[model samples]
Target: MASMNNATEGQHDPATPLFDAVSHPNSLSKQVTRFFGLGQDRIENILPGTPFQRDVMDCAAKDGQRAVGHVVFEIPQDVDTARLAAAWKETVHQTPALRTCAYTSNTGDVFQVVLRESFVFSWMDWTSLGLKDEVVQDEAAAAVAGPRCNRFVLLDNPDTNERLLIWTFSYALVDTAFQERVLGRVLKAYKDAHDELPRQLETPDSSQATPEEDPNPNPNPNPSRILKIPQVADMERATQFWRKYFSGLDASAFPPLSPPLTIPSPDAQAEHRISYSSPIQRKWSSTTLCRAALAILLSRYTHSPGALFGVVTKQAPMLDQHQLMMDRPTRTVVPIHVSCAPDQSVSDVMGTIDAHDHAMRQFVHAGLRNISSTGDNASAACGFQTVLLVTDSDTKRAATWEILKKTE
Candidate 1:
């Protein structure tokens, strides 16, 4: 269980004193330090044990105790680290949750790990609940905070030129219910101080939604927009809207070959594929179309329509081959499979989407959840494709079809 490597003295243990000071008694930090035999000198870029850094850690540790949540902000291509650091510091002074914030790095440079104000506490006080006498974290000790989680090191990702930031928050502080609220505020603060929003692969416009009068079905072909929906409200209305749309579709207008249309694997990686062809000539996003198809099937069995997962739409501009390599390699698409009860109803679909998919996206984007490709058959049942829908506006007018086709 020893993690230290004698060949490199400082390289093995990256723990800094400031990190230990901010995180004590919870055993997560202490465990990491003792297990790795970390050294104070291992943290080369930023000095260890700085007051500012301790404050920031304290803030994050506090928030961690609450329900779990996560936020991610892109560092724009032209962002200036010095300016960013100053803005962050200034914001901390003004914000109540961030008043205790300080730098976590040694050299006074902007460290990759950015902590939010509310994420710095212990989750579920045992004594408060009248349970055992154990306290999650005692709020005493100078330069030290209680109820802190174990800290992890950031590894440089050369491919995307970005550092991976990872840590955990309690299910109490940041769960599906409050994920959007916390992350939205955090990202907005970062952007207000920075120049612009971090560039996504595709950006969808809220206004461009087909005007109620517009005859054209597809307003933006390359539609990648994030839609924010509160967890509890409007369950029936949302379900009805999508259900009616799908049910109204003229199934006979499109080519119907069999129960499941199988496509030859386009590339070597795919094992099988499903195809849905429509005849209405109305424009539809490939992603939306596939999701709709799945929704249609789901409705038949469960009597409810499927809804988009959290973050409504998370897309980056369609990156050219070169850009794809240069930018972060975060996988935007995650596979989800749900088995509805035999008598499931629309209420169930709405409830599930709200509680699970939409809410889970926060953790994925925040680096809390690990997202990867799945080759299992279950993903196929849930409609997995390689080529995402391209916007109609971006392509030629032959009723441009931007569909995501899976490779072999």
Candidate 2:
């Protein structure tokens, strides 16, 4: 089995000239040339998977790969099933990332290989099953969340005239935002084909369009080009910053979760129930408020002046221009160290969180660099004793907290 250390043995720093030339172009001319090349046929490229993807692959190797997101939508009675299927095929034809699959080597290296030949995604009609609405929904979720080798699946409920689309991919390939865009494109393509609209929607050519004119655009037209992971320019400096920031922190700085819970046996299963409401009006943002509360609670529990935790963030801007244009997933979770002095007020902690949040880009870059250097599992908490996940409510009026403990 490949380990983190093994993966780093022969790899060079991603910022090197050779790496940068293939991954990130320094000049507009170079980007233009590469953009055109991506549109060419007979091209086969394997993109190095991001650190986040690498971690997910490692976990999948042990626990089995499952869907990260599953969703279902009601199909209109007027919609034609044949047209919908055609639309889906067209959408997949247009989206290159959808056709790619993760390939892992024995040495722990992972790549997203663009398949030379595309296959139609799986589709099923569950109307004949005579299952209840609730049952169908549950099955849809499970179909995607369950172990499967494919990246995506689509199911249709003809009796209820509803469609359930279930797909799973590594977080490295598509984040929430990327998924939303894809869903939108699929719907638009379906509507256009169904209505037989004469309007022509041209794919945005990065070489021709200016950033301001094409703020939100589809990915590169070519399906075979592999997107590269972004790396920091000064990795050494970023590393020094993290080292200094965490200098005084020890293992006990952030202790384990209180009321220790035992791991379930292999045959045993666990269930979770979650409920959340909008936040009451506060001076701090929802994120700051949550972090402040967490810091205070940790201080009270651990009897320490500070708290350390991992915060998941989508560092989209940190990606290279070509990558940003390609609409790839770049979410990363980084360790955050916050101090709560006895004399400090809640507002003080909020300010601290705000500053830390602003500087998170650097932290993420540094953390990934460290992982690549040490061949450490990027998915591991990387010594973060706790994790804080604050999710937005459906109405976007408030947020909910999901705190997790990292187990070895």
Candidate 3:
């Protein structure tokens, strides 16, 4: 492969160990660093966490060891580990979701802190322990134990020439859609590094995220998800909309008990990924079907005519790129209350809920704050703890992968 990196003398080498792991830029001028840069580590922004992110972090802290999501991959024997680490670092540098870690101040406000710290790539090899693959996998998960948003772990089985690249992250910030975008960049960067290509790490474009997958578009999703620099009016609109929507409702509308959370067990997560992450066949859309079923079950249990729940939405920019939504918690839990007439058929009820979901979604951006009263909306957050997350179908995902692979 020809070298795509064009650098002059005394410059950072693009090929040999791309990440200068242990140090910052050596007091060089901005011009010099830009010209002969190993991409000096520097954070671009530190912003306040959205209500959704703060709520998740607070709940996750008290909750015992919730499942940390991971992606498994098959890698070739000759894959360069050093270059891979550099690629991972570069990926983090470019992507805000993975680069950020949160902290709650003494006054109890959660802030998202972006760290472009010097990359310290650490690895643990359990091959010598003579452990089984399952044990190794468990160990890999354990490595990313607390408040983990990103960690690249590789497990090796010498006997079978088997290697597993496990990219672990928390469910809090890194939802399913976010994972694919981050993973795409990692793979792209790694491939670029392996082939001695120069990949630009940062480019500033202040415009909001473009719609990558628009089966149906909602108006101004940026404010809805509390994305980049939302206007004061946007938030005020949300407050008024939610306050009015929940006019008669209070925290008492929800049950007293938190739902029983089943802990992670082997193969359960894997099964869930395959089953729910892929599309399922149903008369109504999956989102519609789930909403209908939850309402029915709640009505039965509560001995009421309807049910109140919340749906957590994952914002898109579904593919990897330097776009507006690079930072900020784009995931937010919005209150979804459903009711059906006693005389309505299942199909009719479903249609009603589906249409309602579509119509109200436009209000999502300007309305999350006052859902069940903005102050400590713990009750509202708990009301619909279930995400009801929607993912791309297998066929659509595979086709996109083909296109990305074919791209220059």
Candidate 4:
């Protein structure tokens, strides 16, 4: 064997070199900073921590999480575009967390605007208002006048195919309490924007022209029935808690998910009676554990795995099939169906669902896109389904979730 020459090697520090450390900001991080328009440094400083955030954190602490919330509205013909824009602008002005025009560069893009976290915050405030109390009054002591409620303006710009609107809360507001307290005000602004124009803004009738009627009629028709879902609790003691709270009223006698309203799938029907103790509970925490336990009970009773049964997440849009759902706000309804393969065990299915929950945790952290933006591919697994939704977090407050079922 030939003798090998020994060379002295230089030692290097373990730390990454400046050139090697330059990594791109993740999609989520970029989105948060860009949509909110906060400097990359301030992204976390002004983020809102409401029921939505609470839900996310709770799920993140564990291995999985699952819950859904939606807002709906009615879009009237001859909608008032100007007022709507003004109203949205007003919401931006009122919100403290987003008082800054954090993402001015991308604000004009509909996709960016729609997914902007600040926009969702504004819409949440809009949806929280009660029918009767449309607008909230400005507290004189706070030195801030109430939000400048205006109509939501939906107009087609030269660039975009979908309609775009400017509502309040386009920017950041510093006060969290003020933000929560003034949600009603933000909604009132949207309502005002929606109602600015008369139901029918008629143009001058043509004196000489006769209009032709088309024989082709609308292929899809609206449903004639209104669905009512009864509020049921998962636990006996919890049911009793609600019963005692509603002392004079009988909670059990509440209406059921009516006919002509079949659930999207048999699995979704089970979700109808399900109750979650911590709406924001993580997938692996006591809440998920409890949910899994209940699923086991359900499996034992129904002779099915958790995969055979799934949860139906509900979404209510501002506009329904034909017109604006006058009963609610204007927004999109998204139902995220969580089910497993038929052959899986209850525990196995639960594990899969838990994985989905964890994915969502990472998803939200990665920044969120509007359900609409997720495209048709996202909802292909489950079409439309009815669910029992809790309008109020108290569990006692519930409503029937009716999806506009159509033969497409």
How high is each candidate's TM-score?
0.21, 0.61, 0.56, 0.26
Using lDDT as the yardstick, the better of models 2 and 3 is 2
Off by over 4 Å in 4: 1-147, 150-283, 286-335, 364-376, 379-382, 387-408
Best-matching candidate per TM-score? 2
Clashes of each: 46, 0, 3, 49
Say which prediction, candidate 1 or candidate 2, comes out ahead on lDDT.
2
Q: After superposition, how far is residue 214 of candidate 1 from its true place, in Å?
A: 48
RMSD in Å for model 4 = 23.6
Q: For candidate 3, lDDT tens digit of each residue in 76-188?
A: 66766556666777777677677555544333434454443422234445466543454345434433444433555555666677665555555556765556566577778
Which window of ten consecutive residues has the lowest lDDT sum in model 4? 1-10
Model 3 has an lDDT value of 0.46
TM-score computed on alpha carbons, candidate 2: 0.61
Q: lDDT of each structure?
A: 0.28, 0.49, 0.46, 0.28
| Residue-level lDDT tens digits of model 1 in 1-408 | 000001122322222322332333123323333432332122111111221222233344445343222222324335443333333333332332221112322222112211222122111212232111122222121113222222111223345554222223322122232333333443445557566543211111211211111123233322111111112223233233233323422221011223341221223343335555555564543444554445446445434333211122342222232221111112333334333444776455445544544444433221101121111232122232322331233332221011111111
Candidate 4 C-alpha lDDT tens digits along 108-196 = 11111111122221221333334222222111111121111112222242332323232232112222233333445545665765645
Candidate ranking (TM-score, best to worst): 2, 3, 4, 1
lDDT of 2: 0.49
**Residue 337 lDDT (model 1):** 37
Model 4 lDDT, full chain set: 0.28
True lDDT of residue 40, candidate 1: 18
